[model samples]
Target: MQLQVLNSPFSQEQAELLNRILPTLTDQQKLWLSGYLAASQFSGAQAAAPAASQNAGQAVSKDVTIIYGSQSGNSKGLANKAAKTLEGNGYLVTLSSMSDYKPNNLKKVQNLLIVVSTHGEGDPPDNAMTFHEFLHSKRAPKLEGLQFSVLALGDSSYEFFCQTGKQFDDRLEELGGTRLYPRFDCDVDFDEPAAEWLEGVLSSLKDAQGAGAAEAAAAASTLQTIESEYSRTNPFKAEVLDNINLNGRGSNKETHHLELSLEGSGLTFEPGDSLGVYPENDPALVEQLLNELKWSKEDQVTVKQGDVRTLQEALQSYYEITTLTKPLLEKIAPLSTNEGLKELVAQGNGEKLKEYINGRDILDLVRDFGPWGDSAQEFVSILRKIPVRLYSIASSLAANPDEVHLTIGAVRYEANGRERKGVASTYVAERLEPGDHVSVFVQQNENFKLPKNPETPIIMVGPGTGVAPFRSFIQEREETGAEGKSWLFFGDQHFVTDFLYQTEMQKWLKNGALTKLDVAFSRDTEEKVYVQHRMLEQSKELYKWLEEGAVVYICGDEKHMAHDVHNTFIKIIAKEGGLSREKAEEYLAEMQQQKRYQRDVY
Candidate 1:
């Protein structure tokens, strides 16, 4: 009997190969192949069909709103791009900063998309501070009418990648909002992946809109005036007027007071904003790389972004010259003669890869890789883009209209018997002398602004360089002639050595601009004391201020100091307010929900 031929989408070679192998395959193998084709929709050379739009002709509203919470403006940039893309696709989109968003209006949103970045550890970004708290609170209105999506940007190297997005997703569902699409947790290299996800969302909600066509038409007709040029990707180079050592001579640490000119950029920012500065690698390190790799200093190379003259030039100008990633390790693994590198690559452990590269430079990598030659372009391909560092603006716009100031702690550490430096911090603190140019852009942080009601009491917790923004805050309040009471919690190892901006802080206190002053010199006495301990010391009064509508602010280390201060607040609420531990926890949670408690920890 002749058997009928089963024609499939698979290519002829694949079909023939499969048929030849079928007789020798087991039942498990056949089942696996069946499921693979069902899920993957491809077998060897089979071409897959495109997916149909999920919501075609579903009557989508003309008004689309994008809310973004960003610390360094990366999230906001991405959000703006998404809005622009949607507008180009014939949808009317309004972009709003999360800090400025009114929580009461969340229920009125129909087609909503959020782009938020997580801060240190797992906390929400600074701009999303209040919004995140409100969502988890009882005061938040039900979002049942909202159809939303979230694009959470984070660093996968951290333990909590897209933690803020996960929280938002969970909270929105709890409030009965329908998720239009699944939330995407994007890592550092988020550009391509974000674009892909956005396409999916555009396809899914192509037809979902508000009921009225006239209203949609009116909204859609309002065309967006996009910025013609200039962004983090293409920053304008500004001149550095001065970069002086803020710390007194003989001090162990190197801190700088820097000044840069905006000149003709037309960029203006308020006091609470930060300035993102692009820094080049140290010249000494670049020279070392050239010598070790046996490459000429004038060899030109092209990377993913643009072409640059010389491997040293590329490393200094375009790529991250210090930190190493898993991809870079993988790229060099085959050429590496070191047994440690070989074992690490075989294991595929990201953390171990970091360790292997830690405290080592490109020269070290080349040495370990032996005589295996690598082209400059190939080497540059493995490196990540040079990241911009954020520095809190120390001067208020009212004080310096044409310029910005920064308080930088020069990163100087010893590792492997060689001195190491912070990529951007040292660049600004030591390399860029007075009158040199530094590329910079303002990053607005509205969430960390001074209290709207001047009469409201404000308590600020900042230690080390965390004191940077508080200077601006106090200056703003003073300039506005605010009657609000102000309290500051500052600490360092010793009062004599690390009391940054001490003279200015004391002057403010003496002039009555500061209502209360508290200092926590950790190593002053035999026993160490931190700001949280001081908060505990004044628990009764602190709780009284909380009762009297005082606004509490915290900024500094997120891992330990922030957590310690948080615990201290709970203890105060429990003891001073005379509540149980569980109730105290609930009380603090309620305060967060009410936007009475806020943190700006890094």
Candidate 2:
């Protein structure tokens, strides 16, 4: 029997004894015994040969769940990395998006790790709406037996920064869940902090004495991913192949059509992905800051990254100087002797501080606060790292191999009696030349993707530069010879001057690639019709298309255009489906869940 059961390793009498002993051991004992055996094996492997052993420590794998709510893939990537790290450390991990998770099952989870990102104005990402609402609703279950942790990623510029993550953290605690690790709030430059937070959570879950080299090795693997070679922290240097001004002369907009070469970058992007550009500050602004601060251009300043460089170079490329935030004001207030600036950031001056920083910059702070005698290094120490600006990819890699494209709108305005320029936008517009290098990274947006099915119909409504991704979508569909009927509703100020990709639209239409083309130029008419108006104008046909399985997509401003479009959709549904507003909202929500409706609003 031993020879039959164990072909080569053991004799029959030994196998019989082992089987009898294994059956007598309890589940908990078996778990510990397994871990002890694994440790023994690891120890032996280390003695014989160190190269092949992973040294998985002595702890058994813990069951853990990780959920992510992502808008532009940051949260999702972080969650994936965390999951991979946890799994590599001998943890049984279950990873999922919030959209696919059932909220009612939260009570059953023993250990959970939530990684969520805050979208525009502190709203939850579209995939998280149902779970977010469910967690806050009365139907949420108590989780007294559950242990959880949260990693919140957000941009600090918004008033309600990391609102979704904060809500989750509070709600989980309120629902009786115990925190295994303290919640981590990460800013836009979140890579290092997030990694540190992951390590902390790992330390919390594992025994401090037993967790050895496995944690470090697993964590190192998490930093680099298999998806793409370039990340926000380590961007690719893509050469600017071409930069054309799309807006004609006399137009109020300064839209630039930038084509960059991604050759040999190992970066691949789909239609809905965005290209993040690390921009340089204007030389004029840098000069002004140096002059105002009375810092010598040659003065060396150590940036937050710990790299020492000239004050002028740091201002031009490292630290953020164009934008003003509440944190900056608070830091500057203590350094300055001005009472007004100090009062603005005082305990009871939240609203006043917000109001004052609306159209201000670093220069504004210096002018209003007065001369700070702090050294250049001291001043630079308090400043934040310059964040990358993401622009939707306007060209399909399938059509334009080895190249990526962007539609940039140069933002120039007058604020506080000084001409202010958008940091990234003006950098692309005025400073960047053909053959110049632009440090770029591809940010995948899975939420706003083209339909996988070739025969599915699509309706795209994009106003202004929002038309960028739609252009990629159309080009992709056309290049693929998709049999789907494609309709585009694009609007701007003028037909000729403000019309982005006009020639391409006409070419697509002439070649039968574009099934429908609708234009709404607000300045072209007296009535000021927009894309939502056009949707209402053609409501009957729009409803018919919806019934025929057409996917509706809206891109652009989230505050006004996306909101108006959403309301317009509800109204259309109510009128066509003959339902109440509540039912109409449900219908749209259902469509959203089914991926029939999507938005790429910024």
Candidate 3:
């Protein structure tokens, strides 16, 4: 407020009166006033213009709206950053989550920017569903005067790369909205592309709407900018403090509980944020690939920045050889003459190509497709860098200052008669010892968070390692001594060997930190009973809690457990509330809009 008053060319009486009036305006009214100030200020800089701001109290400014559809919060962060940038440029900005936005009011928007992420397959993120549907519906208003752009964040490994983003861009254009900038699609490494896209948006908007740099900068600079010295691209190297297997011996699974020291690094994390770990590939796997290709281990190779390293070093620290994507296949196809490989990539067999890419490794691709190949350098050039893996943090900073913890399930399986290991999971499980350094950075997920109302009840459903964030949540709640009632439903294969954090959880339950607890050990029973079944058995009380306004959180496998649990909730609502399936679904959606239902499924 002080900056707004000081920056404007106003007399003492005028500024004093303005200050009293500004604080009472609603978000929409504030936006209208912001536009007015921007236009009035720019008009003052024009030599031919009179003292318009003095004559007319409110003039129009450049208008922009940033709406985000986020599942894990990457889109939301990017949206915030873009909003800050645009505001710095003197635009009247209104930022909102898609779930909270009013679709009917979109027609009033002059400059629209969407930063969204795709969830599973081709589906929109949970918060984006209704907004996505409304835009495609027959009732959507024509957007002839609107100028828009979209930034899509998605994983390239997925078949439907940026499906939600693509849909929004196409729909807006179909409604007669002019393209402010071309729709920008980004893969896992999105920082660079997103920055470039924001620049393009600002350039286009300023040119079309007449916002000068001087005035734009003054306005946008007033907004707070989020900054961190260490980030995804520039991670902090922290030493490991402890690494222990959570499961007992003879268990079929290997789950590691890792504790890392953040003593000297100023990194911090909240309960729901994720930790991104940059891991090196298994040396054994790299050696096997080198042996299979008959390439020289000592051969010099270059990575991204023309930085030179041995072929062995490059494979270990940089290139991804464990998994293969369709893009990699496309690059390798022309180099091979094998009819079988060629047929998979032939003009019309896209599905067959997808079938081949699934569950196949880079070693398998190289072995089956070639005889006479290029140098090691040529092969390495086509591969992509190994991206960092995100793990739900398991410790709260308030509970254990200067320390961060993670619960990782090491993945090991037999594929094509060879043992394959998960990169970061196994690296921490088998390789890292106490005092060893590991590169990591925190990725904040604002979408999945504890309710601000401490007295509000929360129900957590997490099976396997999905229970990670809940551990942090419990710790945070206990640290604050919050009055909220908390319930946890946990499951694994066996009760004896696989009940992770059992002692601590039991202690919490005894101390009244936990209101209720339920467990499911699938292998112990003759017939399988999962978490969803356990939830169904207690339908009456669950519905009672729902009626009492308790929030429900689900985390685990997206393909099965998440879906099954979701359907189970719909059934419970239908039976317990005596409503039809359709009404139950609608009820669930309404709860979602109210933020009573949230999930962190992978």
> Which candidate's TM-score is highest?
2
**In model 1, what is the error at residue 194, expressed in angstroms?**
4.9
lDDT per residue for candidate 3 within 1-602, as digits (tens), equals 45255678897788888788877889999898788787658744751232243335433336899999998878988898888777555566899999999998889997899999999998899889989999999999999988899999888788888999999999999999989899999987787788778877776665454455554444444333445777776799989999999999899999999999988778988988899999999988887778887678999888867699999999999887788777667777787777888788888999988887777788788678763357878878888888789889999999999999999999999877788899889899889999899999988887678999989999999999999999998999999999899999999999999999999999999988888999999999999989998999999999999999999988889999999999999999999999999999999999988999988889
Give lDDT per model, in order.
Answer: 0.75, 0.86, 0.86
Candidate with better lDDT, 1 vs 2: 2
Candidate 2 backbone clash number: 1
- Candidate 1 Cα RMSD after full superposition onto the native fold (Å): 17.3
Give me candidate 1's TM-score against the actual structure.
Answer: 0.76
In terms of lDDT, the poorest run of 10 residues in model 1 is 43-52
Error of 2 at 223 (Å): 2.5
lDDT of 3: 0.86
Candidate ranking (TM-score, best to worst): 2, 3, 1
lDDT string for model 1 (216-319, tens) is: 33333332234434445556678888877766566677778888888788788876678888888888877777677655767788765455566767877777
RMSD of every candidate to native, in Å, equals: 17.3, 6.9, 5.4
- Candidate 1's displacement at residue 511, Å, is 2.1
Where in model 2 is the C-alpha error above 4 Å? 1-61, 208-228, 304-306, 371-373
